[model samples]
Structures are given as C-alpha cells and as structure tokens.
Target: MKLTVCSSVLLLLLTFSFCHGGNIFVFPAEGSHWINMDILLQALHSRGHNITILRSTRSWYIKANASYYNALSMPVEKSIDETFITNLMKAGVQFVLGTTPWLSSINILTKMVDIITYLHSAVCELVSAVLDDAALMKTLEDTKFDLVLSDPCWGGGVILAKYMKLPLVYYVRWQIGEDAHFGIAPSPLSYIPVTGSGFTDRMTFLQRVKNMILYLVTYIQNDVISGRLYQPTCAKYLGPDCDFNQIKTDADIWLMRTDFVFDYPRPTMPNVVYIGGFQCKPAKPLPEHLEEFVQSSGEHGVVIMPMGTFVSELPDDMANGIAAALAKLPQKVIWRYKGKRPASVGNNTLVVDWMPQNDLLGHPKIKLFVAHGGTNGVHEAIYHGVPVAGLPMYFDQYDNLLRLQERGGAKIVSISTVDKDDSFLEAMQEVLTDPSYRENMQRLSRLHRDQPVEPMDKALFWIEFVMRHKGAAHLKAQSYNMSWFTYHSVDVVLFLTAAVLLVLLTSFMFIRCLFRALCKRKVKRE
Candidate 1:
C-alpha cells in the first residue's frame, strides 16, 4: 500500500510536467526547408510542446492534417509553388552548365535577383494577410504562445513574433541573402567565405576579392531590396522606425542547422546553437522490395542518388548519361527521380519517385551516395559514414561538397563534365575503390556523434530555456545591436590616430620655435 501510493505520486508529477510544455508558433519556408523544419517539430511534439504551424493554402508539402500540431491554413494569392521552383532550378542548371550564352550571364544574375525580390514580395503578402486579418490576429493573441519558432529564411516569422510580443527563436541555416552567421556573428572576409562564392575559408588574393564583391552584392540585396519589401509591413505593424534588419537580429535564439563538423571553422555567437545532424537516426528496416534489391547485390553494395526535393527531374541527356554509367557498374542503384525513364537504364538500376533517404544511408549495403550536395544529404552521409560522388548543380551544393572534399570524404564532378568521357563513372569508381574516402567519412561520423549531448537535446534545451525564462536576452551579445562603426572599433581607431598626429605636430612646432629663438639670441650676442 505504501509503495503504491509513492508510485501514484511520481506518475502525477510526470503528468504535470508534460501538461505544462511550452506552446510554439512555427513559421517555415517551403520545399526542403520544410522537410528540415518538420523534423524539429516532431521533436517538439514528442516532448509534449503545443506546436502551431502556419501554412498557405498553396503548400503541397505542408498539409493542414496532422496529429502532433494544430494548423492555421491561411488563404493567399500565391505561394512559391513547385512549378516556379522547378523552372528556377532548370534555369540555374543551364547557367551552371554554361549552356546559356556568355552575354546572358548578366541577364541571369539580374533575373535571379528579381526572382528573389519577387519571392520576398510573396512572403510580405502573406505577412500582411496574417496581420491585417482581425479574426486571425485575435485568435493568435488568444493562443498566448510561449515563443515563435521560425525559419529565418522568411521574414514573416520575425514580424509576427514582434507583433505578438513573444520571445522568438530561429531554427535557421540562412538569412535572406547570405549565411546566417554573417547576420549574427563576427565574419572576417579574410577567412570566412561567403555563400555561393565557391571559395573555401583559406582563399587566394583573387578569391578574397571575389568574396568581398559577393559580400557587397549580398549586403545590398539583403539590406536594400529584401529589406525594402519587408520594411513597409514593419512600419505599418511593427513600428515606423523599426528596421527590418534590426527585427531579424532581434531574434532571441538562432538554432542554426549546421555544425563545425560539416562546416568550416568560423566565429559564432553564443545564442546561435549548432544542431547539424539532429535529424539523423540509426538505420531502420528497409521495405521488402528495397531489401530484396540490396540482398541481390551480394558482395557488391547499393548506391543511392537523390537530387533533393525541389529538383524533380534532370535534363534528358544528363539523366540518360548518369543512368548509362550506373548500369555498367556492378553495384545496384536506387535513384530518386521523377523524370522520364532514361533510355539507357539497365535492369540493375531502379528508378523511383522517392526512397527513405535517412534509412537507406544508414544501411550497411549502401556504398556511395551520388548527391547534389544539399546540406541535408551531406549531413546524412556524415551520419551514416557514406562517401559521396558529388554532382553539384547550383546554390550552396558545390560548397557543401567542397567541405567533404577538403576532408577527403567526397569527390565532386561538374555537371558540364559529368557526361564527358565517362567522367561520372570515373568519379564513382574512385570513391568506391578508395578505402580512404569511407575511412575519412567514418571518422567524421564518430566526431559528429561524439558530442556530450545529442544535438536534438541541446536544441530542445535552448528552446525550452527561452520559454521558461521568457527570452534568451542574457545570452545575446550587445555587439549584435551595435553599428559597424562601433562593432569594429573604427571610432576608437580614428580617435587614437588623430591624437597621435596632434602630439607629433605639437612636438615639431615647439622644437622649431626653440631653435629659431636660440639662433636669434646668438645673433644678438654676436
């Protein structure tokens, strides 16, 4: 009877703790960004947090039906639909492949910037929809959310967090125009490379110059173009003087979706937490068909290639060339592509719309990952200790692959060169035969998994920390709010420089007067 009473008391306490879990308002971007954000929401759900996800009516990936979280499906005029994204992907691929005319480079750059501005306009439209709706605003206010957990890629979350007067935590890997670090941390151009620059941390003179130029472009686009799109909303809803960039930096915690293990060593902020491979888990049982395919390989293993979600198909020739190369290999292949079936596809090659990427990577029979070098794929490869033959197309793909290449874990081949002279096969054969690649990746896996606490746990702790304390203001540095002049100590440098010049001038004047007076005295005496 005494032991039964003690058990009941313990159970009650556990239930009470779970019942008090924090309420989180989630605003996420579309496509793979949603994929990453959904994983975090799952973690939050398991911990009993009340999660509310806001999605537009046009989102195909993010549906309103889910058990773990409540949804606010708002009607919008337009969402960044897949057709829009796929066209952008194809255009980017053609540019990277150099198929576009040389003179079109400037046009492509301008169009890309315009596309980004237009997308931000869509986001601002959504933000305006939410803020302008009296019923929705009232409903959100009644919810009394503990904090806003947002993907900082979109400005809507930041604005809403302030509008609701809630503590904001960013689940982020990027801001509008550059890596998130450049926004919140100290990024020295000498070492820290800009995103899409395709230059590593250690750069040549020309590389550093290019990084600076890209930095300027990114800064102007982010501060001017992107900022202007959102600033009007900020003025109307947030405040007339409230700066958009300032609103972005005002986030309480930045749960950065990267780690030094997969990223370059760079300066970081205290409030910016790294949870690189938090989405990864041990291999689960494969489906019967996939299992049979793997078992058929016998001594040979399987190679799975996925080109990420936004890119559903490749050009026919490119797809056929890749398929032809994979067919000749002894290893069985499973490729996630929704494109036309390659004419050269062999019986050994299985073309599927999708496969369980994390599970497949963790399987022992998996040999090499032919990847497009997205952050999710790279981190998953690291988690599963799989080397990659990288075919980087656009965006940060090349840079992500470069990190693995620098560490001797992956090999990258250009899309332009992928089909030329059996380049795809050669790259695949090299990583497959080279034990060093797998060894290097395995070593990285150990380092990544050797953290004191699981990355998810750390992420959870900080998110809850903000909720319990109302905000993580104490962890945020004052330097984040300072201007460039004060943050870099330009004022102090100018003051010291002026003071030193004043002293030298004073000394020279006194010496000249003394010399002239002494000469006059000597003349008078003579």
Candidate 2:
C-alpha cells in the first residue's frame, strides 16, 4: 500500500510539472527588437515559464519584474558607448535617407553589402564581449534551459544556442530577410522583395528582375562577406567546429512579426509563423493633459508625429519647415521631438519627448498619423483605423510605407523632394481630407483584428508547442537540407543541357558518316 501511494504521488507531481512550464532563455538583439521580445517574454512569464534574459548593459528597457524575470548584463567595452551607437544610427539614417548624394548614387547591391558588413562587425564585437565574461558564461552553462529564444538579427543568438547545445528558436521582429534565406524558407526572388527593397508584392516585370538580382547579390554577400565575419567570432566562442551556416539553418521555429493582413501573400513554411500585431494591446485611457489637448482640437481633430526611438530628432531645416507647416493647419499636432523645440510652435501644436502612441492613435478624434514609416508604427496605425502620412527614412520603413500607400491607407512624402515642406503638408492634408484613406484603414483594421486566433495567443501557442515538441523538428522544410544548386534545380538544368548537347553531337556524327558513305559509293559506281 505504501509503495503504491508513493508511486501515485510521484506520477501526480510529474503531470503537474509537465502541464505548468519549462526553463526558457531569451537573448534579444539590441534596439527596438528588445521591445518586441519583451512582449513575448512577459507572456511567457505569465504562463509560469522561468525566463532569463542575456542582455547588454545599454539595454533600452528593463522589466519591472526584475527579480522574477532575471537579466544577466553582458559587460561591454568602454568604447561601446552611447556616442558610438548614436553615431552608427546617424550614419545609417543618413545613408538610408539619401542625404549623402554619393551614397544615393551607389548601386543598391553595393549599399546592401556595405550595410551587412557594418552589422557583421558590430555583432562580432558584441558577441565576443559577452563570451569573454567567464562568470556569466559559467552561470549560463550551469542553467538547464529547455529552449533558446533569440532575435537572430545580430547573428549571435544562433552561436549562443550552439555553444549551449540547445534548440534555437528565432523571434524575427521584421519582415523575413536574410534569416529566411539562411533558414531555407522558400522565398521566390521573382515576387518576394529582398529586405529593404521597397517593392510591393504586385511587381512590374522590371521590379521582379530587380528583386531577383537583389536576392542573388545578397545571397552572395552573406555567404562570401558576412559569413567570413561571423566565422572567427563563432570559433572564438562556440569552438572551431561550429559553422555559422549550420547554426542558422538548425533553428527550430521562426515567429515572424508579419501578418497576412499587413503583408502581401508569400509562401511560408510550417516552421515560420506570422505574429505581426503581437505587441499591440487594447488602448488605455489617455493621461489627463493629453486628453484635454486632443479634446481642444475640436472637429478638425489631431495629428500625431512620432519618428520612432532611433530617430529622436530631425534636421534643423526639416524641423522648422514641419513646424511652419503645422502652424498653418487648424488640427492640433502632437510631435514627439527630442532635440531643440521648434521655435515656430503654433498654439495648436504640442512638442514632447514622448506620448502614449497607441492610445493617441486609438482616440476617435485622431485625423491622421505623421510617422517615419516604422513597421510597428504602421501596424498600430492600421490597427486603429488611422490614416498615415509617411516620411520614410531607413531600412524597411520605405517598404512598409509603400505597402500602406498601395493599400490607400497612407501617402508617402519623400524627404529629399525639391519642395519637401509643401509635400509634407500636402500629404498630411490629403490623408486627413481623403475619405478613402479612412475607409481603407478601417477595412484593414477589421481584417487584422478578425484573425481566428489573436496574434499574441498564436505566438504563445507556437512557443509552448515548440517547447512541448522539443524543437518541433518535424515542421522544418525539406529544403533545409538541400544545397543551393540542388534546391534551385540548377544541377538538373545542367544535366539536361549536357544530355541534349550529347544527342545533337551524336546525330551530327552519324549524318556526316552517312553522307561520306554515299559519296564513296557514288565514286565506286563511276
């Protein structure tokens, strides 16, 4: 009787533990990716999963539940200061914005290569710094994590997973790009735009050709240039046997920040899941001052201008021009500006360091959103049925805005147009006055919100599913094992061409012999 009771208790305990949770280690890349990771991590924590974040000292945001959701700050070099990050952002923004005429004239393929090369160098330094910390490495080694979740943008997360001998899951915060290629996802270059290609799904013949060329060039750059950069870093940390390509391809699951409602239809594998609006939540009541400010705008409504975290400030001329334009409008403007307050602030305009962006967008009286065309901003705008005036600056911003413009929910204002001031105001006015913009945005919002499962729930389910299935290896596409040539059927093409050539040669030889025999027979008869 005693033995049976003990066995029953042990079984009950095992069942309870299995039903509850497991250990999860999350390594998020720096910048806005961390914000997206926080949302998922918070959800995981709520589900009783023990979560630990391996983060840099300069992490942008830290969770309130520091004790519960543990963080190990990786020691960075003194040279890796805020100034360094700020300068990098500035240079990147300038390059993408086409502020430098020389850079603008450079071929897009060459520009992409340069961008990846810069990112590769930065990632190597970051990963090396973390690995060099002996104490942190020892602690991580001792911990028995069930799965490794990483934002694979920086190219270090996979290496960390390999070092720990753990299953890797990628929490991709942007549209599928090089990571998809590395994961062997079926991305047909003819349609699927390369990362930052700024092409919509419905492409012209020339656009398709451009897309294909971009993909081929990027593939070569990743393998030839970026691969070499990562090789030494992986060797130093994960040992000489580790291959970066293997580390990338071995990922168990990819939770992409994309939804069919927002993105154009493209082929995706079972392992690649779309969870675009996972960070969005129901709008909270605005703070008292903000509420009064929006209410004061009366029927004309308000416009919210937020350029995202990285672009805290704009150029002096641009800022002054925007301020001047806003002054002419009746609608109240709430501009999130971090630099010197524009001297031309009209009575209807408010300039602040930050505001509750989602809540403000959700407000019924919001006329339009003046955004820098960040994906998160676009998603929020679409979620709230708000039209946008997009001033696209860098990275996928142009692509995101282009799609919105195509869908009739937004208008794009080029930053370098001859009359940018007039163009900016015109776009803002157009989105505000155009009934089609609002109607289209409302339709899109319905589609986004009408998902069978909420994005957050979908993301959570897949995460736990991967944990339960121990990496969900069965979901990986067969192409994951295929070589580049074999996957594209280049080998088959070559073989078929060779066979055709051999047949042609054989036929010619036989015909020649027959002709020679006939000539000889004629001569003998003579």
Candidate 3:
C-alpha cells in the first residue's frame, strides 16, 4: 500500500512537469531550413515540450515517430510546382555562378529581378494554399499553441504566428538577409556586408560605399517590391486589417544560425540568439567501404567534395575539370556527384551519389573539403577543422566563402575561373600545402567547441525560455519600434543639418542689413 502511494506521488509530479512545458507549433519551409528545424524540433521534444510540426512534405531528416506530439503534412500542389522550383533554382545558379550558357548572354540584373519576382509569387501562393486549407487552419486554431517556430525566409510563418496570436520565433539559416532590417538583428550598412555583396567586414572606402548602395538596393527589393507582393496575399488570408509591417516586427526571438567564431563580430538585438553549428553532430564511424578508402590514402589524407543537395549536378565541363584536377593530387578524393560519371576520374577518386559529409569531415584522415560554401558545409568544416576549397554559387555562398577566405582557412575560386585545369589544381595545392590554412581551421574548431552550452542545447533553452516567459517581450529591442531613419540616426542628422542651416541663414541676413545701414549713413554724410 505504501509503495503504491509513493508511485502515485511520482506520477503526479511527472504530470505537473508535463503540464508546465509549453506546446510549440513548428512550420518549416522546404530545403535546408527543414533540415535545420529537424534538429531543433528533436531537441525540444527531448526536453518534454510538446512539438507539432506543420510541413509541406515529408522531410528526409525528420522521422515519423512517437517523439513528436503531432506531424501534419499538408499538400501544396497548387503552390509549389516542380517546373517553377526547377526554373527558380536554375535562374539562381545562372545569376550567381553563371552556369547556363544561353543565360550568360542575358543581363544578370534582369535575371535576378525576374527570379526574385517568381520566388515572391511562390511564397505568396504557399501562404494562400495554407490559409485556404479549412481543415488545417481549423486544426491549427484549435491547438492553441503556446509558440510558433519558423524560418522567416518563408515569410508565411510570421503571418501564421500573428493570425494565431502566438509568440513568433525565427530560425534564420543565412547570416545576411531581410531579418536584419526587421529589428530581429542589427545589420549595419557601413561595416556588415550585404548577403551577396561578397565584401568582408573590413571594407575599403569604395567598398563601403558599394556595400551601402547594395544595402539600399536589397532593401527596396525585399521591403518595397516583395512587401507589395506579400501584402495582397496576407490581406486575403489574414483579413484586410492585417499589415505586413506588423508581421515583420512581431518576431519574439531570432535563432540565428551563426556564431562569432565563424562570422565577424556584429551588433545583435537581445532577442537574437546565436546557435551556429547546431546541426553538427558527433563523428560517427565511417562505413566499411569509406573507411577502407580513407585507410588506403595512407599519409597523403583524403578530400571530400560535395556541392550540396540543390546543386547536385554540375556542368559537364566543370565536373570533368574538377575530376581531372583531383586525379593529379596524391590525396584520394570522395566526391558527391549526381551527374554521369566523369571520364577524368582516376583510381584515387571515388564519385558517389551521396556521402556522410559531416562524419567524413570529422574523420582524422580528412585533409580538405571542396564545396560550394553553403552554411551547413562551412560550419561542418569549421567544426571538424578541415580547410576548404570553396566554389561559391548562389545566395549566401559567395559571402560565406569570402568570410572563410578572410579567416585564412579557405581558398575561394570563381566557378567561371575554375574551368582551367591548372588553376583549379593550383588552388587545391595551395590549401593542402599551406600550414596556415590547417592551423587557422584547427584554432577555429577549438573555439567553436569551447562554448558554455552546446549549440543545440542553447537553442532549446532559449526557445523554451521564450515560451515560458509568454513571448518574452522584454527581450525585444527598443530599435524594433524605430524607423530606418530613426534607427541609424538619419533623422538626427537631418535635424542637426536643418538647425545649422537656420542659424547660418539668420547670420547672413543680419550682416546684409548692417552693410545696407552703413551705406545709407555714408550717403547722408556726403
């Protein structure tokens, strides 16, 4: 009887704890954002919080299991068609890396604007599709979730959170984007480089001016152009009273996928949390075949090349050139190639459809990582202390590579310039032979690993903290309410300029009157 009473007391305590934990609703967009969200969702689930995932499709990273409170897969057939996504990805590659031959003749800026228009339309359609789903919308409303987590990249998350009256949290993957302007973080136009500008924090006078112009252009594109596109859809779904401006500023917390160890030190708002390398996991033992290949390399070591999931297939000439370059190296190469096998691949090279990239990089035998400088790849390389030979493509890849190059751990080679066998080989040789590259990477790895809490834990803690505090409104920066002019003190500058002009004008008038009086007195004396 006494043992039964003790068990009842334990059960009561467990139930009380469960009740206190908040219910989190997660909405992950397609691609890498979905993959990143899987990690955070798993962490949150493990911490006893109930997690309900509302995804467009099944994620390869997220398994269907009992750990999650609920998993809802909504069809987005009318929203995201395959052809549109294909064209969008193609346009992106062409705009940034100049992949398509015919596209090379077209004006790059025009192509970029067209691509942005399509992407904006796609996002709007997605929002419409979600809001149109009566069952899904009703289900979401009935859940009465404590908080909503999503990547602001999609923009729909912000709308959903506001509509549901829940605290919104952003899972930002790229360091540079519209999130900076939304008051979630501070992205100074003077120093901090714009997303695709490819400039470093330390910029020359001319570069700083260029960066400032780029910032203005991006702001217009995102806020003015894209905002207009989003307004109608938001109004349609969220009612006419809904404002896009409110959605931009309503985020309660920003979980930025960056850290000072990899990115340059920049000012961030209190609500902004840095959880870089959150996706990086402990090294798992390589498969037998991979282990054998690594062992065969002996002292020369191995190089792992992956262009990420999106850019799986490379241009034939580029692939052949890269294969030929690696063939000459002493090190064995394991490349993730989705296209037809290259004829230039030597006995030392093994091209496969996929690779356990992070695990392979963690292996002690890994000497180099050749990639397109995606955030995940870059952070994984940093986590594993592997130097990079970066061939940056669209979006933040160029900026990521530039930062890695600045940090002395990477060699950036333009995709246009990489067709030459000698140049490609020379770039690879420099990274492999240079002692500074390895040393820098090793130092960064140490620093990245020396955090007070693991990145995943930090993310989980902050997410729950926000939920427990009921939106954590205290963390919002005062700057959130300020306009661009007020935030940067542009208004202050204008005010001071006006005051100075008024004083100067008054002085000029007083002197003119005095001179006129003196002339009148002189004429009377005459």
Candidate 1 residue lDDT tens string, 91-134: 67667777668888767766776777777888888888898999
Residue 399 displacement (Å), model 3: 1.5
Q: Which tens-of-lDDT digit does each residue in 234-316 have in candidate 3?
A: 78767897767556666788888889898888877777788999999879999999999999999999998986454444567
lDDT: the better of candidates 1 and 2 = 1
- Pairs clashing in candidate 1? none
- For candidate 2, lDDT tens digit of each residue in 1-526? 9999999999999878767677898877656677677778888888889998876575446442474588866655432335555665666656655665684647543655465566567667767777777887787778778889988766777877877788888888531236354355667666777866788877899989888888777677667644578888887877787667656666888888878788878777778888887888778999999999999999999998876355454566667777778777889999887877768778888988889999999999898998888778888998999999888877777888888898999999876551364887787888888899999999999999987888889888888887777788888766756667888899999999999999999999999999999999999999
Model 2 scores a C-alpha lDDT of 0.77
What's the lDDT for residue 519 in model 2?
Answer: 100
- For candidate 1, give the lDDT of residue 400: 96
> Could you say which candidate leads in TM-score?
1
Model 3 worst lDDT run, 10 consecutive residues: 174-183
**What 10-residue stretch in candidate 2 is worst by lDDT?**
174-183
State which candidate, 1 or 3, has the greater TM-score: 1
Q: Output the better candidate (1/2) by TM-score.
A: 1
lDDT of each: 0.87, 0.77, 0.77
Task: Name the best candidate (by lDDT).
Answer: 1
Runs in model 2 with CA error above 4 Å? Answer: 1-19, 61-68, 78-81, 96-119, 129-138, 173-183, 236-242, 308-312, 417-420, 522-526
Q: Per-candidate TM vs. native?
A: 0.96, 0.88, 0.88
What is the lDDT for 188 in model 2?
68
Better of 2 and 3 by lDDT: 3
Candidate 1's displacement at residue 437, Å, is 0.6
